[model samples]
Target: MDSRVVNKGQLPELLDKLARDHTLIAPVREEENVTLFKKVSGASEVQLDYITSDVSPKGCIFPQTEKTISYTYTGDTLEMKEQDEPPKTVLFGVRPCDINSILALDPVFEGKFLDTYYLEKRKNTVIIGLSCSTILSTCFCTAFNSGPCDGKGADLMFTELGDKYYVEVNTEKGSSLVEAYSQYFSKGDTDKLAKAKEEQAKKLEGQFRRKVDLEGVKQVLDENFELPYWDKVFKKCLGCGICTYVCPTCHCFDIFDYVTGEFTGDRFRCWDSCMFPDFTLMAGGHNPRPSRKERVRNRFMHKLKYHLDRYNLDGCVGCGRCISKCPVNIDITQIIKDLKEVGQNA
Candidate 1:
């Protein structure tokens, strides 16, 4: 619960120091209007001004294409190898919405089936969440009990205040990091800074254009799985899978073998989307979700109902990446609003 202030001028030095000791993953300006979280050697590579990255930083923990196991066979002799150890990592400048999205993902990978690939990276990484300075029109983190400055899943949270960053150490990992780099961070009046951070959070909370209400929405989905709303909602969907790809919480994946030679190959798992037509396609050409309607329905159901039922966590973190990216504007906020209306009418 200790707080510190890092002068804006010294932030680069701090990041460079951390980079030398750990794998620094932060947002970088790849091109015009494109920002991504990549491994940076120093603070010079980090883009501190972006509203949000084009894609979620979930790739830092769970990669898009990960080889789980490699196998080699020669004359009935088989050799298998697992993935290498994950590096000590520092994920910096992630917004609260994306931070909560990681919380949504934690259960899925750490459930009955212990995913070592994701867990290892998760264990080794320290998240330094940055409070959002600009709230986009598509943002709706408040609907899911999170906000621009919420620090639920972060190890440390940084709130930019003019020439300095108000740093809140929230975990042991964060405390250790701060202690290691004590020179960069100076002691501030914790009481005043905390009050200022709260005021700032409240101010940013008011800027959200999207007013999302989840009241009775999940219950509606639970009661009426065959609602007529699905018929209308799916009509506009192109089944492009863009929403799932941009979503930080979406964990659906497919596993297959990649052959290197006649008797050697690696078994890989790549991110898959429920929006795709073949997501539920079976071996005998029988697809459970044959059309866009079912696929679309399943996607929302998982977000609003099924995931919570199974994991006791909200599947969607209301990051609004899906809202911004969806070509036809298949908004989750709109869907929730519609579902609530349907529930009332029923």
Candidate 2:
């Protein structure tokens, strides 16, 4: 709950210090128009000029594939070993929408049934959020009341203002980092800089091309299990599962064991998707979501209604990864607008 400023010129030094002290996960541009969050080798590997990474950095916590338990069988006895503790990590350069998505995932993994694997990594990681200087045509985080510079869930948030970066220390973890690197920071007129950050957020907010309204959409979804609207929507769906795969908030996963030897095996969980036809296939050879229409309906309903019903949080963070990456151009913002229409007519 304190503020400081760091010169943009000394950013590399700060990054280098973080890399030396902690496991740094930051965005790196791999090729033309391709950016991803990768384990940083040093400050030179971190890319700061991108609008958004191609994929959300959720893997840092909930990896796409993770070993949960390894077991050894001997006669009538069995022994199992759980995963080791995660390292002290720094998740840097995360955006507001992606940060919110992590919050949505927090309750899913920590409440009632505890996922120690996800929880341990989440606890050990310090999130450094970055303010967006620009907006994309598909970006709609504002619809969920999350703006470009919103920093509700970040440990530390950075807003670029001309010559220096306005740093908001949001938690003790972030404060510790700032304290450790006190030489790189100065207690500038943060109140005025805070106002400048607000003005920057406001200007970027107006630039978002997609305007989404969730007003009565959830109510409609709650009342109806089946919709003719889904029939038309599912037509172009290829059942490729790309939307669910790239989503920051989608948490569906499948667990299986890999046998390394006759008496040993490792149980692992990997990301799964509702868009896949075989996702809900029962071993008895019947699938509840048997077709593209039903699968597509479930995907949208889960994003719009099911998650809200269960967690009281918006499942989709409006990061627009699905919109940008969908091969057939299936857009969730348009779906929300159409669903709002359906609710109105109902």
Candidate 3:
């Protein structure tokens, strides 16, 4: 409940204060055309105005590769070293879609058996979701019931209002944050906050020019699985996996051990995509999802249908990164749109 207007000029000092108690991680401009979230010392480096980051914040939650443990060999015994660098993190300027992805994955990782590594970090990290003043054509968080200034996953949500920033502290962590850094903020009137939130919502929602009926996607896509649509849509599907790697919600991963002449490595997991041909291949080379059509079809089916059945939530938040970054320009939302048409005809 602790909330107030933080003077724009004092943002860096506020970040400096937070960094004292935790490892501050925020979005930083890597180069002219690229931006990525990294460990930051000050808030001045946060590029909050960037349209969209080149990579998603999934790496912050579900890392690309992590060593579960390391082992040392003695003459007759092996000792293990557990990696528990699950330090508290401040994920600043996280986009709505990226934050929702983490929230959505909560049930998956915490459902059957709690993944200690992910859980520890998830519990410790405090999200500061920034409003997307401008939505990229690739952005579609609205389709998933989340908006630009959404306070869904953020401990503290910040929305810019001309010369000042409007703050909404939604959780205990956020309340603590507001209390900890009271000097930077002011008690602002309702008129500014009310108008600021409304204006940002209206503008960002319009920026998502492309729209879809989120409710209709699951049934349409699942029922039309065997249709000849996959071959036609993924006609030029080259099977490269750049789409999933860049996706904010694509969480499939693979575990492997690297053995070399110098050292014996521990088991590590890396990001994996279903688009790869070898992904479905078995030991005897007997593959289930053999063709390119199957591979492409499986990708969509898993996103819309399988995940819905499993988690009762849409796996794809309509971030549309796959469509923008796909080598073949395969729009997942467009695919769902076409499937809805097919259902109407049938």
Candidate 4:
């Protein structure tokens, strides 16, 4: 429960030190408007001023494309090889919404069927969550009982307090790191700093422009899976899979083999989306979700109802990446609002 303070100027030094010890992944401005989480060697590469990265930091745990296994054929004999071990990693500057998304993902990969590829990386990485200073019009983390300074899944959390950062160690891993770098962190006035952090969180909470109401959304979907709502919502969808790709919680994927020659090949697992027509298509030419209506309905149902049914967790974290990236303006906030209206009428 002990908290420490780090002067704003000392952050870069801390990041540099962590990078030297572990694989440090943080937000980097790749281009003018594009920011993504990438492995950095030092603090000079980190972009701490960004609102949010264009892509979620989930890639650090679950890579977009990974070779699960490799094989080689020699005459009549065959050999197989597993992928190498994941590195010890430090994921820095993850926002609360994305951190919540990582919580939602834990059960999925750690449940009945264990995904070692994801589990290995998750086990090795330590997360350092950063509190949001600015709330965008699309953000709705409050709907999920989270806000800018929420630190539910992080090992450590950092909240900006003017010229310094109020650092709270949330887990043993975080405590270990703090102990290792004792020189950089100093004990601060806990009561006063906690009050200031709370005030800052409240101020950011009021800045969210999106008001999302989830009451009866799952119940409505449970009762009315074949509603006319699907027909209307699917019409505008381009099936580009932008929403799923940008979503922090969307975890659908596909696995296949690629041959480099007749004798050598690799098996890969890549991210897939339900919005794609082939996602639910079977080998016998049977497509369960044959049209945009069915696919669109399935996507929302997965976010609002199905995932919760399976994992007992909210599938969507309300990060608003899907809202900002959708070319057709098919807003999830609008869908939730409309679903509430439907529930009331019924």
The CA lDDT at 71 in model 3 is 67
| lDDT tens readout by residue for model 3, 64-89 | 88877766666577667777768888
Candidate 4 stretches with Cα past 4 Å from truth are 75-77
Task: State the lDDT of candidate 2 residue by residue for 70-128, as single tens digits.
Answer: 99999899999999999999999999999999999999998899999999999999999
Instruction: Report, for every candidate in turn, its global Cα lDDT versus the true structure.
Output: 0.92, 0.93, 0.80, 0.93
Candidate 4 local accuracy as lDDT? 0.93
lDDT of 4 by residue, 71-91 (tens): 999988899999889998999
Residue pairs in clash, model 2 = none
Runs of candidate 2 exceeding 4 Å displacement: none
Rate residue 303 of model 3 by lDDT: 80
Rate residue 145 of model 4 by lDDT. 82
State the lDDT of candidate 1 residue by residue for 247-309, as single tens digits. Answer: 999988899999999999999999999998888888899998999999999999999999899
Tell me the TM-score of each prediction against the true structure: 0.98, 0.98, 0.93, 0.98
